[model samples]
Target: MVDRGPAPRRGRPPVSDEQRRRQRLAISRHAVRLFSEQGLAATSGEQIARASGVSERTLWRHFPHKESCVEPLLTKTIDAFRTVLHAWPPDVDLAEHLRSAYQPVLNSPSATDVEAVLAVIRLTHDEPALRAAYLVLRERAEDTLAEVLSARTGVPSDALPVRVEAAAMNAALKVATDDLIHETAESGITPDALLRHREHLADAISFVTRRAPGDGRD
Candidate 1:
């Protein structure tokens, strides 16, 4: 037989950034369900990893701790809100823009995904570790909000007025989301359910930004 070089070694394909993100989100979903069903203290890293079909090593590689497992979902929620805010038209009222744009974004997710998000949000209220993770993400969101608002208002992001507006806007959004999730826990997310949520957010956000009707800043 003719001499041949050793066959090229083959191993697992490289994981893309998107693939890593998806894997983290899948693990996060499993972690959220486990935490909701058994309470945070009762849910362990091993349990989350097993439920996600990953080893504890993999879970730890993705998350720093059990509580941090929920960060992906919470981050998704805050990122979506920031995206909507980024798209807010300067010539349009905040409420009006939200009325037109936010509903479709909310409705885009599957019902199961929506419920998972709501459950995670509720978990934060009772779980100190989860609450810390949530608050940290929200604080990061405030920075993003400050940037967007500063651009619109022509003020520096660190300015007192800009910082205050960002904080208030972030608080309003968080409250609106928490209220809607609790209110709709039973009904799930329906058109009417989301309408209430949309209106509450629009009103709260517009009021905080002082961009209500006749403000001209919109």
Candidate 2:
């Protein structure tokens, strides 16, 4: 007769949102490294699970597809930027605020996580699957930016001008991020470089919206 294991323990405690997010990001970091070293096509969910020290079921619970493993890392930067934008003071210059907040945003992701994210982004250039994922994330970022801009400007998110500004800003940010990723991959990114990039992003938004510093005031 086959020996049965002891009765399973009753109801497991629910994972907190923060715990879930961290788990997902951790898995993503492993996935990105694998996808970068081995081609995405060659990397399997089981391999990713093994690399991340999680069960395959747990991996799928966080990411529906392999390509999506990059989402959590990508979301870290997007979420950091969103947090910075949301905290913009009405009376402060956008560029000034961005410069001041830049350090925190850059520091949001660990050095390892940042490198993983950059690797995935670099893969996007050659992998159609990863490119699709990156594009989807960018679209989501645009919507998020529109919402933030609408709140700051007292305009509807769907308003044409607001939408246009958000799109343009996102585009500029994408370029800046791509540049940063490539540059950092080669050498590394300094705090000053990140600050300058933040200033550039703020300037791009200001230029596209034709809004001067402190114009966000009611």
Candidate 3:
């Protein structure tokens, strides 16, 4: 009788969700670099898979379409910010909390991931498909913001005030993010410059939410 070593364990070892997410993110970083350099129309899924050191099957498993490849990296930034918002302490003001939490958020996404995100953002200007994906992600982020803000402010997530505030805050954040990405792409942002931009973003959110002192804080 010949044994085949228990059928070679049937399949690959089970990967943790975090590991799977990281794999997808790695693939996305490579895809974004190709898209930025070669243009979306010129870049192929096979090229992205090769550049990412993954099989075409693996790449397709992670993303439904080539344009969707950038979503994972772009999501890292929004996820970092959402994490900060979710951890907000009720006693502390949003601005103070953001200022204290911004550094970790800024540092959470790998430098390569950050650059990939910026590249995708820049590509959105010329690639309608990428722009559609970008906008969809932005909408999802806004929904997350609405939920977090509603919890923080004791308002219903569906309330008009909560939705409006969340939308306005999201718009302000998007603008700030675009400006920073543009500047960083051109000249690269120093640590000091990045911190300043963080402060500006926090201040913009504070203004949009009327969270500044004398705006209603006790």
Candidate 4:
């Protein structure tokens, strides 16, 4: 055969950005399960690879370390929240904006994926490495929140209030999420309960946006 050029890589043909994200998420799911079942310190890279049905090399290709496996669980909510904010109507109140378009995790989230989220949360309170990974995910999310807040408030993202609002909102979200996960772990609660709690979350978010005694919309 004439030079067929370098052989194409294996796996799905030319994975799209979405596909790559799904693959990373799949790896994370397996890692979370392994971590939860065997404790973070006891879970091995080999085990993560085996759980994901990928080789050790493939596991490393998807995640730098096993602990980062919880990245998706902690960060996925931010993406959902950002999407809602970006689409929020100019004339709608914040509470209504969230309720009408909140996209409850139970109503919209995949059942398979929610299980992974639960496992990751169980690991978060116990695993130092996973906790660090969760923090990194939030740091990136805070940047996303800053942009969303800027767009909603018509303020420069670098403005003091905008940054502070982003930080405050991100922190509140983290706390709310942490509490929900903890509650879920204890009582086997549903994600609907999490959405129900968003009212208070919305109030906390609005408090920051309304702190200057002005509109909370663009």
Candidate 5:
């Protein structure tokens, strides 16, 4: 997990939505480290709070349960992918757009953030609660994905093809992320090294969608 220097001082002014989000993300980073070092069943909310330099009340205020603490980081990953999809040009192919915009590193997210994400994802394979949280976030992403696909294809978001493609895209992303993380564990994972993973993700998405160039009506 990233070295979050310090939690906000107590008795500070009320936080804005963005401040609250940052706090949650900071707590989440610490929680992921604890979860990685200790299994979900062994970890406690109090431990997470202590690790985050926040109170149990504060941790619970941000996350309902220990497993749910991972939501913010997973949500960040989903949001990054959504940003790429939303920016997809009508004239460009999906793979082509992703190749340019979908860098996992060498961009906004730090190396520590990526490692934390990888740890959380790996844990989900054995931890049912964490898996639930992860899948739920991915499930929620379907709507945003459907909307973007609809805009590109001129199909209603509710249409069967659009919905199926959106869901498939999510699955493809999940699979690609898992594969890349696993592969990078043995080899060193660096900002530049992650670009290959990005390419792999693009390839997975392209294979699953089989979308044609100029498919976007818009």
Candidate 6:
């Protein structure tokens, strides 16, 4: 099985969200460059730690293994989705809102952040372990989307249609992100691509809202 990171974080919050996010992003940056340079299996946590200016213990403190480093990279896209979803307006069409907004946000990502995201996407195909980490993250993303959709629609958590709609939205996002990663790693995931064809993703999310039993909650 792929070396997914440690067990799901079940305990009370460890550190402040900002502090942990900083450390995770720091480790993600170092690991990506190192993996791109030496190749995946050849890179070690110790080397990543040194490159990140942290200790071996600190490396594990953030990521359980070398492959797990990509978790944050994959999550960068999901995080974007999360941010947008949280801010989604009740009146606006989901697809149109995302299509109009995604590019600006993506363009705003720093060069290093973009590089790390591309590096992980390139390496994912060659590493089963990293792929597992990516999938695990995506599954968590489904729950996140579900919760947000449920809250917005006021659907009960166990409602089957809500779950199905959440699944469809999550699935659409996964495909869009995978396609973006593969293409971006080659030529680049362009603004036009996100701005123009991006409605496919929004449509996917919107479809789920329709799948719900009634008019969307919000």
Scored by CA lDDT, what does every candidate get?
0.81, 0.79, 0.80, 0.71, 0.82, 0.72
Lowest lDDT 10-mer window, candidate 4?
209-218
Residue-wise C-alpha lDDT for candidate 3, range 1-218, written one tens digit per residue? 87756556667898899999889978888888899888999999999999999999988988999999988888877787878877877677777778888642334544555666777888999999999999999999889988887777677888887788779878877877877776787776567657776887888887787752222465
Give the per-residue Cα lDDT of candidate 6 at 195.
52
| All candidates: TM-score | 0.87, 0.85, 0.87, 0.82, 0.86, 0.80
Candidate 3: residue 176 lDDT (0-100): 75
Q: TM-score rank, highest first?
A: 3, 1, 5, 2, 4, 6
| Backbone steric clashes in candidate 6, count | 0
Steric collisions counted per model? 0, 0, 0, 0, 0, 0
* lDDT string, candidate 4, 1-218, tens digits: 69889987888677688877877777877777777777988989998888888889977887787777777655666777788778877667765677667642322355555556756766666777777777787788889988887877778888888788778877767666666666666655565765655765676666655652124433
Name the 10 consecutive residues with the lowest summed lDDT in model 3. 103-112
Q: Best by lDDT, which number?
A: 5
All candidates: CA RMSD in angstroms?
Answer: 3.5, 5.3, 3.5, 3.7, 8.3, 9.9
Candidate 5 least-lDDT 10 residues: 209-218
Candidate 6 lDDT over 1-218, as tens digits, reads 89998888787676888888778877887888888898988998889999988889978988777888777666777777877877777766677678766531233454456556767766777887877887788788888877877777788746887677767877888666666665566666566555534776777667655544333443
Q: Which stretches of candidate 6 lie over 4 Å from their true place?
A: 1-17, 103-108, 206-218
Task: List runs of model 5 lying over 4 Å from the truth.
Answer: 1-12, 105-109, 212-214
Which residue pairs in model 1 clash with each other? none
TM-score of 5: 0.86
Instruction: Give the distance in Å from residue 72's predicted Cα in candidate 1 to where it truly belongs.
Output: 0.9
In model 5, residue pairs whose N, Cα or C atoms come closer than 3 Å (at least 3 residues apart or on different chains), thus clashing, are: none
lDDT of 1 by residue, 33-57 (tens): 9999999989999999999999999
